[model samples]
Target: MDEQTGSPDMATGSDRIAGDNIAAYASSAHSPTSESMMSGGSRNRKRSEVFATHESPYFFPAHQLYNVVSMDRSTSYTLKLAAKIDRGFFLASNDWTCYRRNYFQISACFFIPGLDTTQQPEVPCLLDYNGELLQVNRFLICIGAQIQNGDKAIELVQHTPKRDKGPQITPKRMPVRAGGDLSPGPTGLQPYVVTYERVQFKTATANNGKRRAAQQYYQVHVDLFAETDTGAQILVANLLSAPLVVRGRSPGHYADNEDDDAVAAAAAAAAGAGAPSGPGTSSSTPYPADERYPPASSSYRNDSISSSNGGDYSYYPNYGYNSSSYPYQSLGSASHMATQDYREDYHYNNNSGRHDSESYPASPLSPSGPHPHAYMTPQVQHGFSPAASGAASPDMYSPSGFPENGGGHYQYGSPTYPQYPQQHPQDQHHHYHQEGQQQLNGQYDSYNGGQQYDQETQDHATQLAGLRIHSPVSPSSPLIGSPTGVTPRRQSFSSALSSKKAGVGIAGDRSSIGSTRKTRSISMSGITKRAPSKTRTSRTVPATPTKEHHSNGGALGSIGGVLGGIGGLGGIGHGVKGLGISSDRIPENPMEDQQS
Candidate 1:
């Protein structure tokens, strides 16, 4: 049965001519019914024009492996050739198909032990299509190619000294290993496999009027395995290996006569009349991943969807939301463990009770600490604390000169302190009126302006006082004119009130707390008059040395800590105040923050 002509229909002379004409008609019908086919051919042509495009993979099975030039590793085992041909062509070529003059160029890259450098590796074996060994073609050798043997890997590339060679011995192509190959080791011992493929098609004039072009291609892929027997049958396990990656060319052959101008012109006219269409070669820039598809690495675990695990993770994205592209969730037991860490830190601050603030430790210059009123309120400044002598330096509060004392303590008697107000008649009357009022419950019953206000009204007054009030007048504005000792009166009043209302000390650590509160009060009094704000300090934890200490072992640990502490958390409490972040509210686990 003539399969290409589809089992010829049995008939008489009339039927036979009819069938022949129909066959010719059918063969001539090459209108490329599918757009995908045309597009693929156009794209392939474009690719061939822009960048050198290679042909489909070549196939030279095991029996023909050594028919070509071959070399033995350790003088015992022989590397075999096993080309995983592109399925497109493989399906087209069935068994028992004899091809002629089909020449192929092949070279083998093998791993050997004694190499000192990473770049100069060994290139073994060269052969032609007939399996006839070629003369030691030094030009085909690749040294300094990266190879890995278990833990020790090195780059032993072929160094082509200044000699006559076909091509420059630059890094020929990126080295790729077959599936299940181990990564390059630190030590300089690894092996690689290289293969080559070629193809050709010929036509001839015969008695028959039919025209035809014969096509033939070759692919040579290497299979390296450890073996105990000298027969080279037993496949030893691979300690370290990569895919069967080859770097070779796919040169298209124009028939000898076709290579000439007259032949080319005749061939063009024939193609114009009725020539077998070229295979719909894909024109799409074969995304490197698509250009070659290898068998899935056997070493890849079934559940590992990511390419990180030696698996193929190629995808084409559409504009709309794609569930597959979303941040992938692991499907294994370890998935939940990943979530625990995230949720731990996230929940911590969500419910933290104590106000979180950015502490500015007092300058350790004048025996005293940060000013009592450095912050808007004493409670708000609670987050700041002096570092231990061996720790990092105290905060930089005032960029100006420190007090004369090394402890940062300044006396009120210093000339820098403004004088207090005199006992004016209006103030006296207000003081008398305030004495006349009685405390309702434990809270104050009168406002700062001497108005007898209820509890709600007192709360409202305090809130209004904390609101940042802008000073329209510049420091050099006319508003700086005399307030008649008003500044002194204000200082005395604040001092008196802070002294009387120093509530229970937080953390029960009173040594610096009392002084800190006092310093906070004084600073607050000053900042309030100028840039009024209830600025609170955020509690800052000393950063753990994640990066430097655990860089090699745990990359994420250091990264997470560095992110969570200084930079990530530092910028949070800048503008807002009274953001109480108590310990109980914050989860103890730092990982709690990982949850969405």
Candidate 2:
């Protein structure tokens, strides 16, 4: 309703739209995935080639319990909660956002207590991620983490230092305790997160002449976390004892608790009036719940300004989605009674949360049972029960579960958590090359000492020898590439030999070398061979006696022919004088006589 623009204030409507746009634009800016720290924005960290784009959970988990100095009452206290979630790790509108757990990747991290010298405190030194001052190997959960988890459950696993195709480590389910504030309030939720900021008055001062200097201060953005699983919630409870809450500080200055703590408080007051507290245990109450998973309504029941009992809380009951601690005060309501009744349930782990391997004991038989005051009444929930939670069993004590920090607090990659078995930084280093098409180091790739594609070639035809590829070839082979990143064409090499009998080959007979042609050469073995010539031809003229070389000393000659010798032997021939024939009967050929 603008007074000047009589047409019903379009400017005012536009203002509303602009405000919505701004809110939408910045809604997820603070999430751990998108946080500047994980985006290679930290001054202490250099760009990592191993991890080009930042992973979803880029920071490590740091529990305050492990940090002895952080627990001191003199400095500010922080409750860091980490949970495992899916890969994307997007913040959830419900279920207090948590990261998916990967036991293999879970490790403990720690930082120096609050800043003692300044108004604010940071872990004394810079921690890249995980518990490491260096970021390269932070995301990897060492072999020790698996071994530790194995000791707690009935699962066998082994870890190797090199890149070998070995069996993977399969661990048992995480041990989750059964007893806790199943009320869905501060203690029951899986892990609650509320983002808020505070301006430090100690750091503020004004110095511009007496003209009423505007207040100067630094606004501290606080990403608060609280445990949900009884396994981890117990750890949180041991740290926060009693602190009276201040009712009026900076009111909901940031985003209000998405759970609507105020509306829930009014509902609690109504429920309290309707159902008066009795001496009955939580089992008799209508809201029997499992500590791990609680009903939606029961979650914020204790969210009222201040409960009668000062059980652990996420923020100041009265202050703006206030800080974890509050101004001291006394309680006088059923809330106070409730806190007193359930105090004994908080102690799940010791100062270090390590279980004695030699004498691990179930929660029921733990010689070191928590203080008698630290107990919770039995509560029920759908699909779960006290016995079903087997988390209290000694075998389930040490699980490889990651604590989550809601709103991308970087639980897995983000904080200081439990001390995992120490891993040699050297073991985790890996060479990262450009991820496109990689070249084969050797065509004869070997596995377990056996050859791959490259092997010896069989012999070829009789005329042509075969190629026998031995293990080592000359480096000058055409296939070998230098720094040019190029490969030459593959040449076919084989031994070719001349025929053994001129017309023969290993496969079959070959065409005869023409009478004019002959082949001879050396092969891969360096042996030389020559081909035979064409077949012999028949003689045309008769040889003379004088030209003949006699083997028996006499030369066989040809004489003139006589036809009547048989008749002369009968004594009727004219050529024989003793018989009846004369010399005229046997005569030489006239041609022969003429020649004589």
lDDT of all the models against the reference?
A: 0.17, 0.16
- Candidate 2 per-residue lDDT, tens place, 154-191, comes to 12122111112322221111111212111112111110
Using alpha carbons, what is the TM-score of model 2? Answer: 0.18
**TM-score of each predicted structure versus truth:** 0.16, 0.18
Best by TM-score: 2
- lDDT, residue 406, model 1: 22
lDDT of 1 by residue, 564-596 (tens): 111111111121110110110121222331220
lDDT of 2: 0.16
Worst 10 residues of 2 by lDDT: 531-540
